[model samples]
Every structure is written in structure tokens, then in C-alpha cells.
Target: MTEPNTESTTALDHVHRARLYKLASLAFDRPDEELEEALVSGTFADQLLESAAALENDDLEEHARAVVEASPTDAAGVDELYSDWSSLFGFETGGDIRQYQIEYSPGTLVTSGDTLADIAGFYRAFGLSIAEGNRERADHLCIELEFLSHLALQTAYLENEGDETGVAVVTDAQGDFLEDHLGRWIGSFRETVAEEVDVEFYRALGALVDTLVGDDTDRFGAEPKTFEETPPSPLEGLNDGEGDFRCGTCGPTSSGSTPEMPMGDRDGPY
Candidate 1:
């Protein structure tokens, strides 16, 4: 059996965590017919409950139940869901909610090409590339969450094959990635989501992803520096010409929505 450590979580745990992360990514994606069908039919919620239950964490299970109970039952409810999604996560300029990682950083981490390159490096190292159709940046929330999900799934695969070294490498990467990226700002993201979002379903979602990532952050003993603000550049006029970081790499990645498991992918190991 593969041992669970901070550097790497257990195989079974990784499986559940992967599903949880993927589900959160799918939820945040552009609301579509496939997603609506899953939500309306209750399969999304059911799979959520199963994954949360599989993890055997009371808090995750509780929040997962909240998500399940908060599902939309009809088209109108789905429309409302879409409205909230656009209001908080749409393409509108100067939107209240910011999903990109660079938005929360204090220093040049905002527009720093190095940070973006490092993020893309993580993906490339694992044979995971951005989907050709995914217009979102490497630092976008959904992309980052899906990246973690891919890493977690990979960890499980390595562990099942008794590749202890592989497990350690992947787990260590997860820890470092969180400490440097997601864990640092997701708390702030969650706070923003809670404070700005009106709908119960999204609020529940914010809480769920926050809690799941929090648990893993604890497991890795990573204390990421959280940000408080979520808007326009502090260096707006001071550095006018600099553009946001872009890795310019988009290749075979995963992204699709199904009824039962919701294995929506924007990146997968190639």
C-alpha cells in the first residue's frame, strides 16, 4: 500500500481529491447544456456527495451536501445560475471577482513573465498542456484547479503502480504549487466569492473548494501568504505599457462534461 505523507497524499485520498477539484473546475466553467443536464438531473450533486463521502471528511461531506441541496431543478434555476456566474466570473471589465492568480499578488508577480513561465513549466513537466479551446490564461482559477486535479490523479496512478518515488515527486510538486500559487490566494478568492456573490449555490461552491484546498494545504504543512484585495492594478498608471503574463503554450489538454463522474478536463498528461 502507498503511504500517505505531507509530500504526497495517500492513493485513495488523491482519487477523491481529484474528483472534488475537477467538479469545482467544471462548476466554474461556462454554464452549458451538459452541465445543466447534470445539475438538473442531480448527477452532479450525487457525484459530489460520493466523492466528498469517499474522502471521509466530515466538513467536506457537509459542504458537499450543501452543494447537493443547492442544485437547480429546472431551466429557470439554471438561468439564474448562469446569471450569477456571469456577474461574478464573466468577461466584463473591472468585474468585482478576479479569478486569475496574478490579480492578488502585491509585487510584479502580477505581470511578471517569470511567474507565468514557472506555472507553465509545471504543466509542461507533467505533459499537461492547456486545451486549444481554453482561452483562459495559465493563472486563471479554473485552470489552476484543474491542474491540481490532474496532479492528484497522477499521484494516485503512480502510487497504484507502487512507484513511491513518483508519488513523492508529484506530491512534493503539489505542495510547492499550492504554497506558491493556489493556497496563497484561494482564501482571498473564497472571501471575495462569499462577499460578492448573491446566490446560495455559488457561495456553497466557494466554500467547498476553499475547504478542500484548505485541508490539503494543512496536510502539506504549507502556510501560504493570503491576499486581501481583488481588483485593479496597484501599478495601474506607474507601469502603463506592461501587459499581463502569457505563456503562449496551448496543446492537448482535457475538458469535457459527462453525467455520472463529471470528468471535465482542460489539461491532462500527454
Candidate 2:
């Protein structure tokens, strides 16, 4: 029900895009002491709530407020929550909270070639690049969300310049990106996060993600492409012993050669 108000030509839209970017960035980046402090101190919550209010998204405002309200009050509590963050996102205790779109999307492998390349191309077209030290791929959920924020900010700029063509382009890009990438997997991903983490703050975030994706999908009439019916992987059929199997993705695998490597274990398009 909540939609972006693009009628304004002021700083309001910029502020909204910034808040969305911050929220998305937090989803991927490791939670640190500073982040905990920000949550407990109410500064981050205020900014989030203000942005949500400006956008007239009451659900988002409530969710943002709830995260701050549920934040740990003491230092030890914050540390515990930080540990929860690690256990849920980091590989601290074999974390199951996957932050990549490919991992969540049906029929998508960790090393999906064209999908990753296309996403990276979009980033480069916008003058964005993954940080050198960043461990995640360009299609990582956090990166994708940040890209959405970038698109929104860019849309505002185009609007300011009265460049109708540019505004339409940016708008179309947002819809396409969401439908093709995030929208397809976000619902399942949100459910996974909520199921994995017991922290109320994180659960609230999961709810927010679910709602945002659902809202946008409906708003744009985005019929996301589902690859659920995609054929089995070559590796899956290799053990059948029916006949010779040559993997087009990797190389030859005719009994004596090394087993075909996993898709993600090799170098990415980036």
C-alpha cells in the first residue's frame, strides 16, 4: 500500500533513499560495536522513523521503531546480540542466514554465470563497484538493496534536472531489477531469516523485507521469473552412469578426469 511519493522536488526524497540504503547496507555488513551503540542511542532509529514518515509508509515506520525499542539496553546485552548477529550471518557457528540472491532464488546456483554478470554490469553502468575488501558478490542481498537505494537517489536527481527520459529510465530499471532479482527471492529469504534468528530486532527486519518486496511487486505488477522448473544440474545427472557426460559449464567429465568443480568454487565473472 505504501508507495514512493515522487512529486516533491526537495531533500525529502534524498533522505528517504539514504535511509533505505542504510537499512539495506546493515543487512549485509557485519554488525559492530558502533552499530549496537547507534541502535541503543536512538539516533539510528530516529533517522529511520523520520524517513519512513516522510515517505508515508506507516508499516516501515513501525518496524524501524520496533527494532530500536527491542535493542539491548546494556553493553553486555549488545554484545550478546552482536554474537547473535555473527551466528546468524557470519560463519561463526555455521550461520544459515544466506545474504545472496542466488542462494535463495529457485533454480539458481551459487555461481550462476549470466545472472551475476548482468547484475555486475548494472553496477558498473552506474559507476559502482564492490569494495576491494568486500567478501560478498555483487548480487549479494545487501549489495542489491544498496543498488536499489542508488536507483532511487538517481531517480530523484533525474527528476530535479527535469530530465523526463532519465527519470523514466531509472524508474524502469528499478522495476526490472526488483522483478528479475530481489522480488523473486526476497519472500523466501525473509522467511529464512525469521526462522533462523530469535532476536526480535532481526525478526522485525525480516518482516520489513517481506513487506517491502510484496508492496513493490504489487505496485509494479511485477511477475517475477521463476526458474523452479529448470533442469537438474549436470553434476546431479553425472552419477547416473547412463553415458558419457561433458559439462558445458565446467569441462569434460568422462570417468577418469577430476570431478566437475562446483559452480561457486571457481572464479566468478567479476
Candidate 3:
């Protein structure tokens, strides 16, 4: 969502947005060998950095460049990222960071309740539910990013079909989703992750996600709520049983896809 050269109307713009979401989704999730290969071969980093370079955002371009330069070139380097990922996001690491949106969205209480239900309502309205057996909640960072990917794709489709009304509806939903959920907490999340992680890979990711969310906020004029009082403490229950997380999308898959849901031609009440 780095401010596009033009409005998100062109085919190239749609493709760029899609790529941004996909990369962000992978970045926030646990690292694996497939992702390592993509990074080392420059397949993922090159595309992302190239897109950022095209943007007018200099900070984004710089972070993307750093990510490309610091990318692991061998299995050992990838293993280092995996280890860092575990320490940063795992339950056993005594980490204060929580990836679920509800944990961060709350003002004083760091527990899940209505906020989680409302987030699930948004997904269900779009015919999306966590894939069966996917233990991650609807508000998990990776799930939210993947949902944005679907929204971007839907916007692209509407644009292609010249459905201005549909585009506006989806665009409004995007802004609403950001304002209510991701935008509200991503700044704090980015700061926490950057402070907690030791590896450059995650640092770059924090920068990238921060940049994108900032741009999205500006584009949509979505004012993120401020933490007037002290932010809530990290809820121990949020990470209590989050055992050995893996990238559902990029990890070794024995059957179907991840918790990702595709929005083809199905009409939903956006």
C-alpha cells in the first residue's frame, strides 16, 4: 500500500498491491525453507524491492533494499532466521509480543472477546472462515494480512470489470478493516517486533509492514486511534499454548492450502 504512482486502477497497480500483501503475509508468519529459497534466489525480495523502488516513498525503498541485501544466501542463514522467529513469536520464549489483533486492539484489557467476534464477523461476511483445523484465531496477524490480499484481489477484479460501485464497496471495507483493526495496533506491533527480534530479516519485515500500514492509513484517511492512557499489558493467555508455529502457506503441506480463502466471483455483502 505504498502510495501508488496513480490510483489503484491500472493492472500494474493491482499486481503490486497483491504482491505487497503476499509478501507481508509471509513476512509476519514463521519462516521455512521455501521462503528461504525465495529470499535467497531474489524471487521474493527482488519483486518486493523493485515495487518499493517504483514507489515515491523513499523510506520504503530503503527498507526494501536493506531486506534484499541482508537476505540469507544459504541454509545456515535461513536457520538463523527460523531460530529468531521462534524466539520472537513462540510461547516458550517469554516474549511479550502478541500477534493476535484483539490483544493489541483492546484499550485497557489485553483479552479477547467482542473484538475477536466482530473480526470473525467481517471474515464470515466475505465467505471466509479459518480453514478447518487452523488453530490461529481470525484476528491473527497472518490471517489479517491474507484477508487484505483477498480484498486487494477483489478490488482488482472490480476495477477490471469497470464495476465502480463494487470497487467503492470493497475499498470502503478495506479502510474500515484497517481503521478498526490492523491500523490501530500495527505501529506498536512494529516497534515491539523490531525491538525484540535480533535478525535483520524480521527487522526489515517490521519496517515493511509499518510502511505499508502508514501508507494505507494516509490513502484512506483512516485515523488510527491513539493510546491515550497506558497500553494494555500483554495477556499471558494469548501465547500460552501457541506451540511451534509454522508458515501455513509456505510450510510443507500434506493436503490443502492454508487458512487463506479465495474470493473469485462470489458476491458477498461487503
Candidate 4:
């Protein structure tokens, strides 16, 4: 007789999908404070962490759906939030959302065309699965989705009691997504949003993304790349055609000139 498979199979359900979809929507919809509060205090937060701790995928689809539905509505009160989001994530920006919808959104994934409505429809159709492509941009979306998926899975495991296999799978998926994709470009994306946009929601969301990326890296024993940490140049020191780093102490210091060293007789004394 053939051996029966003993491993449990857990597919994502409506509640779970809703939860993740709502979280993403909220990330784009509300202000940072509101989003933060929801993530910490709401059922979304509870279920995510719980599932990660336990590693269950039951009802994960439902959680993802909840995230989608709750997202756009939660931020309805703040028009500015959507405006900034549109600027940052819309089709014109050449950002991930545009690329994501192009590559993974159900019917649109394989077909070719560009339009705002088309992209929005794609999001509506595929919801969170829009991030599943193997391309670079798709990889980023995958990372974001994996993060949410891990939280959902963790919540499921916790609620149903500890399940090692489920937790391992969730953690493995999260680690793979991060180490392979989102971790690679999210920092640049966050910097772009922080530098180019004025919206508090995006800024806060960027910070949250940074935090989550860091946390995931630490969790998976991945070493992050160190970008140049140049401090913001003083605005007052800037002049016509001058770059921010031009030395202010020495007026109009030539960009190519090396400053003269102090006339200490160290060569003779030392």
C-alpha cells in the first residue's frame, strides 16, 4: 500500500487574505500614526504575529482580502494621503506598483498595455498576488507580500497552538523573499519616497518598511549592505551652482583642490 502523506496542507482563506489586503491598503491610505496603531492594536496585528509564531496558513487568503478591503477605506478620511500615494505609486512614477500590476495582475500579467485604470483594475483583480512575479520589480512585491504572509501564518499557528512545520515554512518563505529580493531594493525605494515626497503617510510607511526589513534581516541572519551615510549638507552654505559638500569654512573652495595642511613641524619633531 502507498504511504499516506502526513503533512498538513493549509491554504489561505478569505479572512486571512482580507487582513493582508487591508494592511497594504491602510499602508497607502492612512497617516503613519493611524497605520501604526492599527498594526499594533487591531486584529490584523494580532493574527499576523500569532500566525508567524505558529506557522499556519489556514484562512490566510481571508486575511489577505481583509487587508485589501480595509486598506482604501481606512484612509478615506485623508485625501492628501491618497494624493501622495498616487504620486509615489501610480503608473507615471515608474515605481513598483506600476511594474507589479504589469507583471502579476491576473489577465494583465501576460498582456501588454499601460493605463492608470488598467493598473487599478489589475490590483482589484489580483489583490496581493500581484506581487508574485519572478522579475526584479515582482521580486520587491513578493518581499512585501511575503512579509504580510509570514505575519498571517504566524498568527494562524499561534491561535491553533504551536505548529513547528508551519512556523518553519512561514519563516523560510519570509527569509527567502527578503534575502533574495525586497531587501535588495527597498532601501533605495524608501530613500526615494523620503527625499521626493512630502506626505507623512509615505514617510512613515517608508520608516516602517525599513524597520521590517531590518527585523527580517536579523531574523534570517542576513548581512545588509551599507550605503554611504552622507549627512545632509547645510542648506545655508549652498550658493549659486555650488554643490552641498563645498567647504563652507574656506570660501568657494575649488571642488578639485585639496585643502592645505596646518603648518606643524611634525616631520622634524616626530
| Number of backbone-clashing residue pairs for each candidate, in the order shown | 4, 0, 0, 50
TM-score of 3: 0.77
The alpha-carbon deviation from the true structure for residue 183 of candidate 4, after best TM-score superposition, in angstroms, is 1.3
Full-model lDDT, candidate 2: 0.69
Estimate, for each residue in 104-185, the C-alpha lDDT of model 3 and write its tens digit.
5545334457788878887987889888888987888989888887887888788889898887777777778888888888
Pairs of colliding residues, candidate 1: 254-265, 254-266, 254-267, 255-265
Task: Residues 1-270, candidate 4: write the lDDT tens digits.
Answer: 112121342433323532443454456532466665564455545654443233243333333333333333343534555455566676544433331322322233334344334323433432443445533433334335444554545545643666676655554544544454455556665676668766554555455445455544555555545333434445645554543454444433234434665333423311
Residue 184 displacement (Å), model 4: 1.2
TM-score of each: 0.79, 0.74, 0.77, 0.43
**Residue 216 displacement in candidate 3 (angstroms):** 1.1
The TM-score, computed over Cα atoms with residue i paired to residue i, of candidate 2 is 0.74
A best-first ranking of the candidates according to their TM-score comes to 1, 3, 2, 4
- Which of candidates 1 and 2 is the stronger one according to TM-score? 1
Ranking by lDDT: 1, 3, 2, 4
- RMSD (CA, angstroms), candidate 2: 10.3
lDDT of 4: 0.45
Model 2 bad stretches (over 4 Å): 1-11, 73-75, 108-111, 218-221, 225-270
Alpha carbon lDDT of residue 42, candidate 4? 57
1-270 per-residue lDDT for model 2 (tens digits)? 124334443545654754666674674467776676766676667776777667566786677677667766677877887788888887877777888877765455655888899889888878999889887887788788888778878877777788888876776677777778888777777777777778897887777766665655554456676435235566876754654464536534334444565334333311
